[model samples]
Target: MALSGELWADLSAERRIFCSVLLFSWTVYLWEAFLAHRQRRVYRTTTHVPQELGQIMDSETFEKSRLYQLDKSTFSFWSGLYSEVEGTMILLCGGIPFLWKLSGQISGHAGFGQEYEIVQSLVFLLLATLFSALTGLPWSLYNTFVIEEKHGFNQQTLGFFFKDAIKKFVVTQCILLPVTSLLLYIIKIGGDYFFIYAWLFTLVVSLVLVTIYADYIAPLFDKFIPLPEGELKQQIETMAKSIDFPLTKVYVVEGSKRSSHSNAYFYGFFKNKRIVLFDTLLEDYSSLNKEQTEGEDGENEETKSKTKNKKQGCKNEEVLAVLGHELGHWKLGHTVKNIIISQVLSFCLTVLSRRFEFQADAFAKELGKAKDLYSALIKLNKDNLGFPVSDWIFSMWHYSHPPLLERLQALKDAKQE
Candidate 1:
């Protein structure tokens, strides 16, 4: 009877509810992937580029970008399906809860009494994490080696990849083990106010992590080379001052070491905020700016003059305009707003999250950067997540930023107020 009871308890109706939720979530994910594909299809079918966004890319590069988007969406759909299925199978087979129970057993063997809820919680979290990582390792490998390489973006050697994987695992465990344990411990000790205090704890941790990430954590992955004194730096500063945006020096991260993807972003709070541009972004900028071969063997005065005089295809004004858009996020307090919404109203994330993209674009335009920003976007078009996709349904759930067309239209219609 005891054995039967144990089996019966294991197969309780609650498990069914949990499995159902898992399946539903996966189905939603697959549907989102389908919508991404649909968006790509629509983009392919549409020939006419709107005047506002026409300069984003030339016809040829735009076609290549569309194909790339299609490829990515196709891969994501299949991989997403496999992942969902794997998760569902694990749930249906009682793997996660079994793992949880085993974690408790192991913790007990270590003399962490079962009564110690914190130890049990921490053990379960770690074991569960390890299990998931092991299961997902193959897919991660395939993604980096096959899919990304096929797209000409995989730059890490096998040695670097393994080292990175190890570092990430160690760093994540170090951080999450303590944070998650504390949250769970709070639940045990706080009683009725557990959730309220947990919420507050999350907010503080989020803010702290944001402030320190560029300093403490990011150095593990890439080098942050300081941008030297030049027109680019000077213009960026000028633009910041013109808008009363407190300025700091900019950095150029060695982004091309891992992927050809490009980006620029801001970090720090208030006066300490820093702008970071990607090496790939500067690759475009190099066409307009003189290249300095300071440490090169073939350097001569004539070569230096030629490198300096070489016409970098991008303009300084346009680059500053891009910086202006990034600055808009800080000015509008979008980052803080996002943190609050995510911690408090996570359910409303889909709706409330994407507006800030538009707001920042508008802010950039308001800073008298409209035309130059347009020019910059044109140069950086293929480097972004843009494609011609008619993806209304796909966008409903997954889009955390406005579509390129929408962004371009917003910029066109924006005015200083």
Candidate 2:
């Protein structure tokens, strides 16, 4: 007891904190691995469509979803293990402080000197992010090329992928470096309430980014065009006007250029609100239709025929139903509520997020969109090859929205009522 006490006493606060952080990180990782194991078990054993899923999913689709999820789970396991081991090694080897000193030296060589702590800090941040990107690159490439390509989700050619990646890195650095510099400067000059100032600064930055992302940053990568005049546009405008949603413009982003996944969202504050829809979400306008008409490069008739048979997107009414759900978010103040709660009460976030989704679903139901939304949900899930089933614990930890079946049930109940 005396020897143990003496040893514990000899451990400095910094050493204790360092060891504690490592212990906590590993503990979290192990917990995640265990959760993943349970989910993977479900993926492996649930080979056929369950009685509950029979109506919504066919045997072929279910099997494809099962295999896709299994592959994703396997990939996640290896990537997660690699990340955990890398983090542990970095901490054990004092990688952070070592990199900090190296960054200082680099800045000094560039005539910035140690007194320019901001410059050294920027150098350190850049080096850190670059290191992270480099280390994760192989896993990313494997996911995009091997896993996603095999599953028919990957759309970018190797050249396009690399070009896009480089563009993203450059744009990210341009934004990150300046923002971090400003943040560090604020901290240095803020004195006692640096935390408060930092929080406010981040809040402002987030709002600004949300407001400008679709307009400025997003268009830098993907193409965005105004939703052309049509029946769909007219109906959407009518729906918006009915709810006083402050909808200003609608855009159809060519998201199919990267992936076949469909999505839609509204952004901006007050009257400047704009809705952006992935081109993949519109049955009529979807680029997936092209696959039916023409063969891709190097694709033979057999491959082209297989691709052509794969349908994507939703009907017009279903698209309107999706818009109804999205508009519900705006009308119900879910977005603003979430932002505030996320910044303040983060612990309750996951549960509250799920609740918010349900509320939005209910609002859509109230808009007489229950049946359309239900069908839309199933179609979207099938198109994305999303695994409808989830482990309870995993769902609790990770899913912000309720599972497909649960939402469908809720919508059905609402419709019946």
Candidate 3:
């Protein structure tokens, strides 16, 4: 008892806080790992497709999806473990304070005194982000080149990939450094209610980012071409008009330059709203229709090894259906509501209840998009090779939206009604 009391007395508050944080982080990781293990077990053991999935997923596709998900789960496990260990080691070894001291030294060499605390903080932030990016690069490369390439999803050459990565890093620093400097300056200068000023500054910055992201920032990374004069464009315009949506223009982004995955989204505020569609989402424009990579003059490895996968993208009506669902979010104010909710609440995971999703689906149904949306959902699920089977706990905890099967059934039910 005497030795125990001595040991307790010897533990500093800072040490206790650090140990507590580390313990909390590991606990969260272990919980997530347990949930993931359950889901991976489903992926591994469910060799045959469930009866409900039979209508949408063929045996080959089912097996492929299962294998793909299993591989991803395994990769996630190892990567997550590595991250936890890295964080632990950093904390244990005083990596943060060491980096801060190093940043101070660097800033001092640059002729910035301790009085220039903001400059020192900026240096520290840059060094921390640089370190994080460097450490995570190998994992990113493996996921992109190994896992995605093996799955016939990766679309970039090594040169293209590296160039893209460098561009991303540069752009991130450009945005992060300025915003962070301004934010710190605000916090430092605001006399009593610094927290309020900081919050307002962040809110304004977020809104500005959202407004400019698609038009300016995104186009820096991906090519955005106008969705040309055609039936699809006509229908999209008509649909927007019907909902009184003040849509300015539609642009198709060249997403296939990086991956075979397909998506669509809208951005901007009030009267200046624009929708951006992935080129991979339009049937006529999908590059997945062509042979996947360069220099496959003859029957190459992918051609020889695998059967031609199902063609990606949706038909004109299906595309409209998908857009209807997205526009539903706008019309129902779900997007704005989500932003407000996220601003107020700090969730460890971004999992929200599926009420908003179901509401959006129902809104689409009200727009007479039920049949088309149902088929579109199936096509998308197949195109992305999303594993249908999920452990309930994992799905409930992790998924922001309801499952594909659930959405399909809801659409079907709506159609019947």
Candidate 4:
């Protein structure tokens, strides 16, 4: 049967709406993914110096070069433009899908005159989300296994990675499915009025999650135990006391079981405050220190043999210096400022989270231990060298955090003052 011109017009309009919405969503997703890839390259390059700090032939020149690369990268006029592009794409990716789906469902309901269209809409939304996540998993695998492994950073077995992924999926579904269902129910009942209450609920939940992440959530994946009895523990306690940073707990995390990279973090607030040092860090620091003592009289056959044997320690001084740098971040109000700045930026720029990272690095220096911080920074850079610097810089700028080199330079500048 030949359709009337008016009916043809209506059909054409529906096709246009569907295609436009889907095309817009996919375009946004692709743009975001591209920008994120660029940012990651930048950050990876910048932090590479820190990972290799111990292996550098000349520390001073290497430090200067690292700082120069960082400054050059951060202050480049093009960098800001790239930064803006990355940021804008992220917001579009996050918001566009929701809007497209919502509008499509509304239009579908009007056209079909059927309640089942709403269910279809919800199903579409879920499928979109699932598909997005599924597409991301392959890239995640590539990064963790191929890219990281090439750079000597990947210590995780394929089994470990998949196991972790499955566990995470289960945990996320357990938490998110119920929350999402509830939110949708509220939206169905209250319509636009539910947004205000939904926002409030989201805010409260986010705060609660942050508070409990270290104590409850973190333990699910890794083991944590009190910092062992030793001079290391005493030094940490003494430093905490000296800085008037009340410390009730310090724990060593089982990070080495998963990777060779070492890290230390400070977490919790008020009475719950604690410090966690990676077991790898402790082992490496101790080994390096032992090597230095053996090589004290320059090069000799016996000394060389001893040095080779004692490759697991770091100087106690360096450890203290690194700890001091972390403490500096807290003592100088960097953490609080970061939280506030992040919230404000989330509303305004939506991408300033990465820039704020550089500011935190500057704050870390103001707290003391600049030399140790520099050494630690160098070591971190060297260890992470395989990832392209550009990817690291831009990725962190796009989503996660800040570039390592920028942070190190900020510390250097702070130390000079």
Candidate 5:
């Protein structure tokens, strides 16, 4: 028997919807890639004063460069807006058809009605997620490889990136699939009351996951070792003791193996708490004080000059200042406040993220001198491409971090006391 004309038309419509969504996503991705390429070109071609200038010049030049890049990369704005519109359209397009098909199949059966609906909903959700991931993976790869590499910021090898992706995918499925199945099962059997119980269960599970993330999950991907014995470590321990922070273990992470960025953080609760510094910071500090020859034999006068020119590359005082700032986040209750604020803001617009970032900045100031923090911030700012400070609202909604200028200003204001 031949298929009916109406059925053929419906199939065509579905196909067209899928094609349209894919086409729009790809177009937006391509435009973003092109803009990123242009921004990199502009950054590389632009000339600026040398970094050895006085602190004010260094900060100003860094801010200007960042603003320039921000203006050139308006692609983020366009892509972000398009992403929301495209995502909603694709969901509606795929979901409505799935619902109709499921409804029709269930109506034809007697005892299978409730079971079919539950099964179909689960299947539909899985299919939708899979489709989105598959469609989006190419753009993620492009960003990591083409865009990041062009700017010399990409530290991940293709193998590492893929391995990370696989691990994340497995973890997500392991956690999500069982919970989804259970929820659907409850909905099938418990009818209306299942939703209340499901909500409570989900909230409890989310809290547990958040608690375990820093302690249990983070170490699975990155190795953390106790910060080795050194003057800096002793100083940190002394500071912790002064604050009655119960000094136990200090650790350094192997972040430099992946990227040149330097950072420190405090993790865990109570006695389980520990501080971690990046090994890159350690290496940078060691090299700065020495003749610049370490594990690599290619190190020469040129290497030493380049290393010296790198803004605030691994200075112990700067590291201490940065770590102090992070400690401030904990000491001033910014960390706990941030957690509560995040939960409250999860359903709202992204303004809370920016505000919390400023609060952390203020907290950092309470722990360290504003000048030291400002200097570290200036160095970090100069080392990377700057985005526009005026695009706070756009960036707050799209990006995870606050502008460096905003952070600097917050520190400056806090220093007023």
Candidate 6:
């Protein structure tokens, strides 16, 4: 008999293990949050900036950074705790099975039988997604309107928020309905080797999404205006040429419409590849605005290159420094490698990704502008109000990006090479 159907005494053993795993995960996250909170407190009280990062920000900016982290961590901790509790409820309350049963009933009422793969799968996914969305709405609202707004990062108005939400719903349904239906059909057709076929199908879909995401999907949210003829654009193209990184049209997105953080990134593959910069980043870094402490975070946050602005004049060299780091990924083939790793079923593959990050940094350093790249990194860390994770275990096992300190050290080490 299935564990769920077993006698209470027998089921208790398995339930204990599941509960323990859940509890352990929650505890680790809470502990990490605590460490981050403590780290921020230290930053707030101390005037000492790490020798490497001091060039990027002053004591005042450092305090500002610490304050941002405090707000972020506080929100992260409480929201995480709520998520854990909600997840526990969902599991123990038999909510998933109930949702499944409800989906079947709804589909059947529509003249689709329970055994119809496409209908059954589509209905379940649709309803389940709706349920997830409704449950998550309150937290999303608080994050956007309350926490983000408090941190000066929220650019969304209520009208824009609702519009984004509706668009997301429509887009998700458009993608999910057909995708889930096809996957269900494949499952019905493929028996023993279903997993192999499913993996291949997923790989194809992932590749397609990546190709279109920056070009097509992103434009759905924000406008992309071509970077005008300027020193910055010339430098960007020149750097891409030097690295032999595929360059298409360089377009700057109006990312400030959503958030006050700035970024540069390269997206797509082959002929489709393009370099994109957030307009806020260009404005912040181009003229080297000593007064502007923030930039638009941009739509694609997947790139690394943290910086905090210091009182300096605009140097096209600084923007080029950021571009060098982005091109490093394209030149080194880490982007496609990352896509492959993400799609595979592996436990340790993710940890191995830290190597790819370092390698890309090395590539950036090799392209010259090592000092500018270093400066950009410092600004990014300050701008993002980021700190190094003190917990070594969590840093190694969980962090997707290398900690800021680690990257700074990496840049320092790269210069030696």
lDDT of the candidates, in the order given: 0.72, 0.88, 0.86, 0.59, 0.61, 0.70
Compose the digit string of candidate 2's lDDT tens values, residues 66-102.
Answer: 8999999999999999999999999999899999999
Considering TM-score, where higher is better, how would the candidates rank from best to worst? 2, 3, 1, 6, 5, 4
What TM-score, to 2 decimals, does candidate 4 have? 0.62
- lDDT by residue (271-345, candidate 1, tens digit) is 787888877677544311444444354322212122222232346677777788888887888877777678655
In candidate 3, the residue pairs with backbone N, CA or C atoms under 3 Å apart (3 or more residues apart, or in different chains) clash, namely none
User: Residues 261-289, candidate 3, lDDT per residue (tens digit)?
Assistant: 89999999989999999988988887667
Candidate 3: where are CA atoms >4 Å away? 1-10, 291-309, 346-353
Q: Name model 5 segments beyond 4 Å from true.
A: 1-82, 88-92, 99-123, 182-196, 246-248, 280-313, 346-363, 392-402, 410-417
RMSD per candidate (Å) reads: 6.4, 3.0, 3.6, 10.9, 8.9, 6.1
What's each prediction's TM-score? 0.83, 0.95, 0.93, 0.62, 0.67, 0.82
Ranking by lDDT: 2, 3, 1, 6, 5, 4
Error of 4 at 312 (Å): 7.0
Weakest 10 consecutive residues, lDDT, candidate 4?
299-308
On the 0 to 100 scale, the lDDT of residue 373 in model 3 is 90
Candidate 5 lDDT over 144-231, as tens digits, reads 6766555544566777777777777767777777788777676667767888877767767777676677567777676677766788
TM-score of 2: 0.95
What lDDT would candidate 3 get against the real structure? 0.86
Evaluate residue 368 in candidate 2 and report its C-alpha lDDT on the 0 to 100 scale: 91
lDDT (10s digit) by residue, model 6, range 100-168 = 888888889999886675786678888878888888888889888887776556666777787888899
Give per-residue CA lDDT, model 4, range 1-417, as digits (tens): 357556556667756676566567658666755665565445435433445333432454454444544433334434445445544564547655665566566657666444544544554555555655675677577666655454344556777777877777667766765666666666677776888877766767777777788788888887788877889889888888887887889988766446556778888777567998876566543322343233454322221112223233245555666777677667767666666665455433335545554544554455566666666665654443312244543444354444455555566655533
Q: What stretches of model 2 exceed 4 Å from their correct place? A: 1-6, 291-306, 345-347
Model 5's number of clashes is: 3
> Best TM-score goes to which candidate?
2
lDDT of 4 at 302: 21
